[model samples]
Target: MRHYDLVILGTGSGNMLLDEEFDHLRTAIVEPDRFGGTCLNRGCIPSKMFVITADAVEDARSAARLGVHAHVDPVEWKAVRDRIFNHIDPLHDSAVNYRREKGVDVYIDEGHFVAPKVLEVKGEQITADTFVVAVGSRPVVPGTPGLDSVNYHTSDTIMRIDELPASMVVIGGGFIAAEFSHVFSAFGTCVTILQRGPRLLTAEDEQVSARFTELAAQRNRVLLNATVTSVEPHGDGVSVTVACPDGTHVIEAASLLVCVGRRPNTDRLDAAAGGLELDEHGHIVTDSAYRTSVPGVWALGDAVNHFQLKHMANAESRLVRHNILHPEDVRTLTNRVTPHAVFTNPQIASVGLTEQEARRREMDYLVNVRNYAATAYGWALEDTTSFAKILASPADRTILGAHIIGPQAATLIQPLIQAMALGSTVDQVASGVLYIHPALTEVVEQALLAL
Candidate 1:
């Protein structure tokens, strides 16, 4: 049997485990497909590349409102798509090469747990003192009737398309749905979002979700509370039958995109052989220290049921590394405020608790909101859409949540994230700091003052 001190399954953030600190310890990595995992190959990096181009196209179209009178030429899909892949594909290859050059044993195959501390990879048996499972997640396809017969694209396969469809019917209203909706819509496709819920962006604050729905409606049709019963392939298109409170409605489009959610890729790992427990969602159950039910086994990233963001995964990877190095000094991955940003037009970003969550908990919170139009920079840009909302606890004036919907909303929410992570009070953000005049961040400062 091949032996090593450490063996890490999956190479997403798990690759971070190969720090110089672990150079003394013999390590082996097993990866089935790409080296950089989903974030680099398919998820975050690629999606953002497409979204940024869409943003540029949208900006050019709206230049008339900004007094620029700019006309957007046709988007060369092939050229644009090829450029992104050209940049990313090489980086992916280099990542794999770097791991090997660093003297880490790299095994490119599917790895399955055969026993508590043993993993079988590509017909080879390997044992390690400690093992890390970070296999990540994949798109979950629901069991809808006729879905198999109809042609559809998922987050993983959508970007590799030869060309953009003329029109698309998007199923589900999650982050994947919203991001793609904006991408395709900005690219001149007639986009329609079919959400089964009452509103889109269910994970965000209710007010923010409602406002997002309104803004999205301006660009494309948003069908809310519509449950799809069946989908069938038409000639070069798809027919969707949805049952809603209004009644049954059928729609057709050139393509259908599924953005429902993702499922943990734990089934193939044979975790049961290692005596590790998984939740009902198939995510590995880990303690605050990222230790699995089985000794010598640790899990993080999407494979675990914690925050699924790339930054969060990297953070957990560091925590697991620390625990592995010094079992005596344990660290917990809790009490840290997690922030999420959605990349839609009039982008949405938020951290900490929602107003509704605070109210439900009865946490003595005060709410304050500032319209983006109220800012001087807002007038210079001729902006009349979106707002910033802040929620703070009354007793200590600590920022519980900060939500924004406007240009650079994702960038503007970072200060609040710093405050929440550092446990800074609202007064510190509002009075102690000096925001550049006529900047987008001033809007954040204004909201904090109101709180």
Candidate 2:
């Protein structure tokens, strides 16, 4: 059995946890796949790159409204795919090389616990005085009948398809489905989304979800209250048997992409053998200090956090690193109001509590919604469906929640996230800072001021 001071499992954000500060301790990293986790290899970075191209295509299509006709010729899927991965795929090799150069042992294989404080990687029994498990989540594959027989793709494999399909049937309503659907549809694929819920992005505020659903329906074939009963190989792709609100039917498309959800990787890690407590949903349980139930074993990122967002995972990683080093003085996650964004048509971004949560808590709150059409920049872009909604405490008018849907929603929500993180009141956020004239941010300013 080989032993070390620390053994970090799964790269992802855990790779970023290492710096010159830990030079004294003997460290090793075990990864089952590529060095970069989902974000670099599959999720955030590559998807956003695709979205930027999709956004450009969409802008060119919508240019006629601005009295400037534009056209995109010869949309090359292979070139776009190669360009994005050409830039991204090399970074995985660099991460491995960088760690090796730093005198850290890098094992490019999966590791699982065989005993307390011990993890076995590629048949090697390695024990560590301390363990940091940052193994991330994977795309959920539900047991829809005959699913395995056909060739299908998840977010992990869809981006690399040799050619853009004539049509695609997406089987989820979350951010992944929204983003990819926008990408392919903008590139001329007939996209259809199958959502089991009544509205897409059910996690968003109800009003925002309803508006997004309305907008998305206009762009693609969106089936709500849908359930996939079965799937089988038809022609080139798969035939999806869907039971939706309307009736039972079959959909034939050139591609099928499943993005139902994701679950933490604790089960695969055999965490029980290591005496780690996992929640009902298989997420590793951790205290405020980011320590697991086991004394010498710690976990962060998707292994512990239910947020399951790359940014959230990155934040947890920073705290876990500190807690591991400074055991006596560990920092808790201070930014409770973590913000998130969905990069799709009329992009969506949100921070803090939703209005439903406030109402459920029976708190006195005020709500204000300002549409993009009311802003000067909105008029310039001829935007009508985008808006920003703000919720605040009625008593002191402290900002409680903010949701935005429109171009640059992700960027506009940053100031609101900062305000909420700093516990700034509505008036302080609305009036304290000056919003530049004719900017899209004026929609946020208008919403907060109206609140």
Candidate 3:
């Protein structure tokens, strides 16, 4: 058995903790797979690169509406996949090499704690005075009958496929389904989305969900209120049986992308053995200061956070670092104003409460909506199907939430996020700020004013 000052259990956000302050301590980082973790290798970064290509292709397809008709070239799947991975793979290597050179012991093997503060990695027993569990999450493959016999892809594997499938059947109603559907459909592959929920992005405000569903349905076959029963092999492809409100039907496609959701990696960690607590969903239980049930044990990122976003993970990582270093003056995470965005066609960005959540909580709030078509920039893009939604407390006029769906929705919603984070009011955002004329942000200004 060997002991160390610290042992961080993941390379995702955990990789960020090796700052100058920690350089004096003996530390080890355990990463069983890729060095940079999910967001870099599979999730956000590379996926967005793919979405960028889809965006360009989509713009060309809609160019005729803007009186600039041009045909897009057929997508070369090999070239696209190579371009992203070729660049990202090297960066992962560089991260690992750089960390090792900094006097940090890097363990490229699966590891878990056998006892409190003790970890077992590749037949070696190691102990640390303090430990950080940042192991992330993995795609959950639902147990549908015969699913094992057929070929299917999760978010992890789908992007690396050698060639684009002729057509695809996306299973789920979340951001992954919407974004991938956009990518494949825009790349000229036929796409059909089978969602168990009544609508896509069910977590969003109801109106925004309806509008996204409306626009998405125009581009791909969307089957809502769908329950997938089984998956099986079908002549060089896969066949999916779905139980819809109408009736049970079989849909065949060259590939199946299961985007149902992700599950935390805590189960594999055997947390109970280490006297660590976990939630019902198998997420490691942690306090606001990122401390686990057991003293000297901390967890963050997808392994513990409700919001499994890279930015949130980074924030939590920094908080954990501060708390670990200054145990006497521990700092709790300030995550009340976290924002998220989905990179799909007519992209979606949101911060704060959804109207449903507010109503469910019985909070007194004022909500308002503004259509993109009403804005000057909307006329330039000829956009008709997008809008911005804002909710604010009437008493203080404090902006509680903001959601946008349209071009640059991710970038446009940032100002609203800033307002909420800075405790700004709806009127303040609309009147106090100077919004550029004929900009898409005018749509946001309009929404705030309506509030």
Instruction: Tell me each candidate's TM-score.
Output: 0.97, 0.98, 0.98
TM-score result, candidate 1: 0.97
Looking at model 3, residue 189 earns an lDDT score of 90
lDDT of 1 by residue, 1-451 (tens): 9899999999998988778888898899989978888998889988999999999999898989977888777788888889888988887578778888888998888989888888898888999989999999999899999999978999999998898889999999988899999999998889989999999998789999999999899999888999999999988999999988889988889989999999888998888787889999999998899999988899999999645688889899899989998899989987578888888787899888888888789788899989888888888878887899999988988888988988999899998999988889999989998999899788888888887
- Candidate 2 lDDT (Cα, whole model)? 0.91
Give lDDT tens digits, candidate 2, residues 191-275. 9999999999999998899999999999999999999999999888889999987799899999999999999988889999989
Global Cα RMSD, each model:
1.3, 1.0, 1.0
> Which is superior by TM-score, 1 or 3?
3
For candidate 1, which ten residues in a row score worst on lDDT?
305-314
Error of 1 at 407 (Å): 1.0
Q: What TM-score would candidate 2 get against the native?
A: 0.98
Give the per-residue lDDT of model 3 (tens digit) for 139-218.
Answer: 99999998899888999999999988999999998998899999999998999999999999998888889989999999
Off by over 4 Å in 2: none
Cα distance off (Å), candidate 1, residue 207: 1.0
